[model samples]
Target chain A: MLEALLRLPPGPVDLTALDPAATPGLDGGGKTEGKAALAALGDPLADLQERLFAEGRADVGHGRAVLLVLQGMDTSGKGGVLRHTVGLVDPQGVRITSFKAPTDEEREHDFLWRVRRALPEQGYLGVFDRSHYEDVLIARVRALAPVEEIEQRYDEINAFEAEVLGAGTTIVKCMLHISADAQRERLQARLDKPEKHWKFNPGDIDERARWSEYRQAYEIALERTNTEVAPWHVIPSDRKWYRNLAVGTILHDTLARMAPQWPLADFDVEEQKRRLREEVPVR
Target chain B: MLEALLRLPPGPVDLTALDPAATPGLDGGGKTEGKAALAALGDPLADLQERLFAEGRADVGHGRAVLLVLQGMDTSGKGGVLRHTVGLVDPQGVRITSFKAPTDEEREHDFLWRVRRALPEQGYLGVFDRSHYEDVLIARVRALAPVEEIEQRYDEINAFEAEVLGAGTTIVKCMLHISADAQRERLQARLDKPEKHWKFNPGDIDERARWSEYRQAYEIALERTNTEVAPWHVIPSDRKWYRNLAVGTILHDTLARMAPQWPLADFDVEEQKRRLREEVPVR
Candidate 1:
């Protein structure tokens, strides 16, 4: 079921063919069981993260890391996924970068410049709430760049992900698939709640007006950039619970496959213990 | 009680005069009560952080932020304070940077250049596990830089901190003070436990040999760079519980004084709510 979501086939991708409301990854269980499954993953996820962090600290060069890129339409529950899924791990082992509009200085460099700086160090889990894919997604929808430049970015991103994967970083890109109806409901809720008004931007309506164009952009992005090294998973995000579960499962599986072990210490442990116990003078 | 820990007086300071084990900021509460007090601060700290984050998002220029700089020797529990004290707030509102030995690129720039880049954006609580103070602390003790360069850094740091503080950023610098006896016990414990061996570096012993020199370096730093905008606090860290309590209290108090409020909405609330309810057509 998860394999169906992975846009791994080398063919033209059609966003219209996929149902955003489908929960193919879930078992027969509903939201209640989905929540329970997510809860069950907590301990093992933390344990795996500890081993990963320990591996990074023990050996820098051989350390492995994971980078999860989350791209979605407005109100697609990126914040919720961050709070529920990524928040479960130790903050020490996680590095999250929430990309906003680029700054003047960032604009001076290539799009990948700021991104390379924010990559997770060895043995850490790096998350990008919105990532370099924005160059192709929004840039394409709004025609911010020349059509040729936007065309160039898809290949550039593919090459970039290949380079990072070669350096022992696993990449998982998830597009939080949501219907326009779901987005409208979420945006309306944000406007209705005074506390949430801070998150509601009127510009989102304008973006929604260009929904078809954005969908076209994402379709092209998924088709062009999905490679064997880095695949894009179109998660059914209409249900926030299932979205969180799928992401958590993906991370758990990735970390388990990496199977980072505690690195062996350089010094003689018994000798060091003896020295600490007997020879070290306490002031 | 917290007043006693603040080095607010404008005068020469001596590190030897301070007691590393005294719980000056904590009341008559022992470790048990200190732990409870730290736990008790969780909600209010989270609340204050939300307001700060909201303000940053609503208005970029007018938003306020806090930068907490923690400097301590090996085994002084900087990692513990981060995991326990700073970890209480929402991760979105907090930016934690653990600065190691500078990279070759970082070394090419002025010391403050890398630091300036890492400063928390408006509405964030920025924490430096180890910070630029290393320039004047380790660099001074090890004579890594020239005598004149080390001396110049004190003023340079003061100016740099003043510039940040002037821009609506409140800076709180903490020196986690642990006695040599406490440090020996910690380092020894790390060596005795195989899992902790990764954290124990052999060069720490060489640093332990120059304890007095490092203390002198800290003394000069606290005296010369402590300013009206950003003051230094000597935290008695021999007791982990009390250390967490003191740091948490300092943050709660500092944030209370800053008093970030939820920003007022720019648009008409009722109109937006009505539009969301009756006007905007959901597809």
Candidate 2:
């Protein structure tokens, strides 16, 4: 079921054909059961993260890392996924980057420049909230750049991700798919609550007006950039519980496949211990 | 009881007066109960962190931050405190910097330059694994600088911390006090385990030989630098569980005093909700 969600086909994609509320990964379970499944993943993810952290800090230099990229429409539960899924692990071993509009210094460089700098170091679980796909998505829809230049970003992103993959970072890109109706309800709820109004942006309504264009932009970007090295998983995210569960499950599977180990020491352990007992004072 | 650990007295201090095995903050509880008490703090810490994060991300610029500095001898359980205490909060709201031996670039700047760069942004909980005090402690003990120069750093650090406090950041400094006998046992244990040998440095033993000098150095540094703006808390750290509990309790108390609030939004909530209901499409 997880594999079915991965964008592996070598053709143009249709966002309209896929159901926005599907939960194929759920085992005929409701929100409670999905949450339970997510909770079950906590120990394993933490254990894997510790091993990865230890490996990265070990004397040897062959350590690896994992990067989880989350891309979605506004109010589509990216924050929910982060709070519920990645929040289970220890913060010491995790690196999270929330990408906002590029700064003046960032704008001076290529799009990938900031993205590359934010990549997780070895032995960490890196999470990106709205990644470089923004270059081709919003940049395409808003005509922030030339159409041909936006077209060039797809291949550029693909090559850059391939380089990262070759350098021992496992990348899992998730596109949280939510219906326009679901987004409307979410936006309404945010506006209804005084404490949540800080999250409600008036400009988000303008972005919603160009929804079809953004969807088309996402479809083309996913079709052009999805590769065996880094596949895009289009997750039905209308149900926040199922979205958290699915993302957690994907990350668990990815770390399991990596199987980072606790590194062995490079010194003569027995001899060192014997010397310490013989020479050092213990009270 | 926690107040007893805070170095609020305005005079010279003696390290010998503090017992490394004391558990002044614990309620006469054993390790099991102390662990449970530490565990109880998880929810409140997480909640405070979320409020801080939300307030920081809001348009208002009045959000404040907390910076916890962990300074102690090697094998004094700084790592344990970090893993057990600060680990309870969301990584998204925390920024940790582990200061190591100075590099060429770091040495080129004033000692506080690297530390200033790593200070947490508003609403974050910043942690320094080993901080700028090393310039006074190790540099004094090892005679890396002239005696007059090393003596001057205590005043410099006090002024630097005063500036940081003025910027709306609460600072807590903790010295993980441990016995030399405990250090020997920890070093031996590290040497006995193959996986732990990487943490064992032969140079540590050389430093251990000059333990009294190091103690004297710490005493002068703490006495001179402890100020109302940033008082040092000398935590008993021979027992790892007690150390974790004491530090966690101190942080919990500090943040509770801060009382970071969930910010009220600046927009008109009812109007925005009505606009969403009328103008937005909902399936």
Candidate 3:
């Protein structure tokens, strides 16, 4: 199962792989290095989209269940990936669930209630805009739970996701790795642009102040929860174009490996032709 | 603009056209008469699904906007149509918005703001599991609004839907027509099965008592809002199989007419051949 998901060969990562000790914008982390990574992503956006859509369709037809969970900070381009990626595939076989503040009834239940209900059925792809990882991420960052409780939830989430995967749901978890500087730039752009103003939240600036804490929480979340069943991809998202292409490539490659089966022809041509000859009126 | 929208026929509907007013387990409703209508649907299952998926893809390609609104009372088979219809289309291009209780921000604005944001972009389809019509249907049936306010809402909804359609969005409104007896049977089915017990609600029994009032509201909604631009299809959903087939057929047909364009091929055979010829080494 693990071998099936490896589509693209491991290339050199574009960014300094999340080294907190490294000096910010030092020689090792120059702007030119980022550009080189973007260059590494192949050109021609339209062709890439077409290939992704075809791969997703074939996987669904094969009756192989695949679930993609997008977990990231608010400005981490989760919505952008959803809008652009789904724009390529047919909507029939896909379901996207955006988890918001839990309802009174939902709050009474465990966090997984809403998420479990939103999982894609067999022969479908379900995308969670944010998922159960929140139980650990938010709980750890905000100290919503006791330290022991927070640590315990990780095992529960891993077990829960493993069960889902065991039941034929292939899981792909993506953590959009954006730096503090990039987050500030995106949030500011949302405020600066009229159409994107709806996306900007004044509270997000405060969240940005505690960026280090959030980054620590995310790093822990990835390190602890990353399993063979649902390994997390720390996608470099400073460049939105490159981020979209990288995620798109991973998804396209994964589905191609799953190789969903299509239905066989129901009728033979000779039999159908003979029946048509007997039943038809003169044209 | 309205005239052009009106020119498009509501397409295939009334899965049980000959069996109108038919209730489940009742001989008088001419229930079996739906055979011809079901046959008219053409695609038994796969064909219907294929058409629905193809048309949805076409709408996205042509950059033709489409909005589908489904509304009905309890046990009206809203879930059935949604399950079967959406089951066939590509899930990526489709967005299903289920309007439950409004949020704090939603309450601050008019009912349409959240809905406006949910509208499909160019080359996409937006599905309303329940729509703004709730302001009229539920409000009127429950006596939650004054008679004048309810009447005002009907007109507002009609105009609002027409405006969206004029802006190049194809609006398809389907009212699942399940008989009163059929609803009781369905609600009971939920209660009888252990797995389905979660779906059972005692409040549904009380709602059945006010069935006539709900019917009156529906009749008015159908009459007032049925314009040439966006007509309501009263699908006879007492027959589950027929209901799925009819709704699927109409949606497929409407989308087919829009004719979405596919991504252009980018691989140039001539250039490839020339490059190959130049690169070929003499043995």
Each model's lDDT: 0.84, 0.83, 0.61
Q: How many collisions between residues are there in candidate 2?
A: 0
Error of 1 at B29 (Å): 4.0
List runs of model 1 lying over 4 Å from the truth.
A1-40, A60-63, A274-282, B1-33, B60-63, B274-283
Angstrom error at residue A237, model 1: 2.4
Residue pairs clashing in model 2 are: none
Model 3 misplaced regions, further than 4 Å? A1-16, A19-63, A266-283, B2-94, B97-125, B128-171, B174-283
Q: RMSD of each candidate?
A: 2.8, 2.5, 17.1
The most accurate candidate by DockQ is 2
| Model 2 C-alpha lDDT per residue in residues A125-222, reported as the tens digit of each score | 89999999999999999998898888899999999999998898899999999999899988888877766776888777779878888899989988
Worst 10 residues of 1 chain A by lDDT: A1-10
Give the per-residue lDDT digits (tens) of candidate 3, residues A39-96: 4433332233233333333342333567888888878888767755543444444678
Report the Cα lDDT for residue B51, model 2: 73
